[model samples]
Target: MNELLVRSGGLYTTVQDTGRFGYYHMGMPPSGAMDVYSAVVANMLVGNPDDAGVLEGTYVGPRLEFTDDRMVAVTGADVPVTVNGESVEPWTAMRVGAGDVLEFAMIRSGCRVYVAVSGGIDVPVYLGSRSTYTLTGIGGHQGRKLVDDETLPLGAAGGRARGGAAVPEALRPALDVPAELRTVVGLCSYRLTEGALASFLGTDWKVTKDADRVGYRLRGGSLDFTEREQPFGAGSDPANVVDLGYPVGSIQVPGGDEPIVLLNDAVTGGGYATIGTVISVDRDRIAQTKTGDAVRFTSVDLDTALAARRDRRERIERVRREIAR
Candidate 1:
């Protein structure tokens, strides 16, 4: 087996892939990379499978030394990176000599950075994924974040095909957040007061610092449905009771009259009233939002949402072709 040693593991470095699925019923949160699109892009750049295990780095990246020559790609947040002391850019495939050292600094734009190897990190998978879920100790590198002195498995390296990998110049994801995040009205929408639905759809909210793997808490105008109006009003939606199944993008209103948008590591079930769910297409924006960023939820008809998703997929495909060329 080839070796990839962590000489100096940085802050919050962990092994992640797409995520563990089909186990939420067993009370396992699908812990994975926060910016899944970026992660997949980096993996693809290195010619790895879309779900290959990669490194999810936050704020800083580890000091790593390779045991053999290999091709690698790093993407996601703009974390200053260097080989030995020289600089490197994100979204570019690079060759690392056996003794070369790679380092990453503080975050400049977003919070997470993804590093993907040509053949992907050679780690045993659990529940069909190699993502690290620190909360429950389930998948990924020992089911916890990587730390100093940790050794990771490097994929087979003898005479493997090597090539440069890079993101297409014209098809890079926009760093700017979109104006409105599309949502599908939920079953519990009726529980909220008449204005609650409209207020959530039209007004703006800011992302609070109180966000983490579980969920993002939003701060905005109070959405009062009153204690009396809620119990039976919005029935069977995400928020109506505790322990009901929840999907990733579920927006549930708790007692504070504010909604919390569930993310990648959100719980499988909860006791709250869900007003709406942000569609899968707009989840990337929610993943990159920083504290104090303004976000507005907009309701869109099913057709518009489907069309938007199609456009995004087409754009990504075009970019892939360009990069391949």
Candidate 2:
């Protein structure tokens, strides 16, 4: 195994894979890389498994010195990275020799930066993922964030490094908001009051400061729901609410009427009524939003949603075609 000695771990760092799945029934949310698309791309660049153990850094990235030569890629946030004081671009794979010092500054645009090493992080997996769920204290480097002096072991490079993996120039995914967010009106869409659908689809919302892996509390004009007799016995797990099975990406609006977009690490069950769910294609955009960023949710019918999915799939196919050429 190779070694990456942590010299200076920045703000918050954690080992993340594609995330835990099929365990939400046991009250475990899929807590993995926030930018799963970018993370997968980075891993693909280095020929690692799409769900390999990568580093997810918030606010700042970490500093590491390698024990052997290896290829690594960084994606997601645009955190200024440098190797021995020389600047390096993210989302591209590059070689690093032993004793090379890699450092990263705070995020400039997005929120999380993913660093994928050549042979994947050599951490024990739990519940089918290497992600850290800071709340439940499971998986990922002892179920916690990275700290200084943590030397993580890496698997052997396996002697394959002929092709350089660069972030596709045209496929640099945009994460900015105010762009229309596609949504499949939720299981609870019919509960909204008259005109509520129009208001929700046309309104602008800002992300509040209280944002994290758990959920995003959006600020916008109140979305009224036709009041009805409340149900009983809903137990909110992980976050503690009346029990109602909560799906990831479900936008839950409590009595306050503001929608809260649930993310990967969100609770399994909750009491708040979920009005809409941000479509999978739009989720990456939502992940990059920050406080006060303007966002608008667009209503896409089943047909439109299917078409959007097809368009994205075609884009991925195009990227593959270009890669093969």
TM-score of each: 0.88, 0.90
lDDT of each: 0.75, 0.77
Clashes of each: 3, 5
Residue 89 accuracy (lDDT) in model 1: 68
Question: Lowest lDDT 10-mer window, candidate 1?
Answer: 229-238
lDDT of 1 by residue, 30-72 (tens): 8877777788777767767778889987666788887777777
Over 130-171, each residue of candidate 2 has an lDDT whose tens digit, in order, gives: 888988788888888889997887877863543555657778
Which regions of candidate 1 are displaced past 4 Å?
158-163, 177-179, 226-243
lDDT of 2 at 325: 47
The reply for model 2, stretches above 4 Å from the true place, is 232-242, 303-325
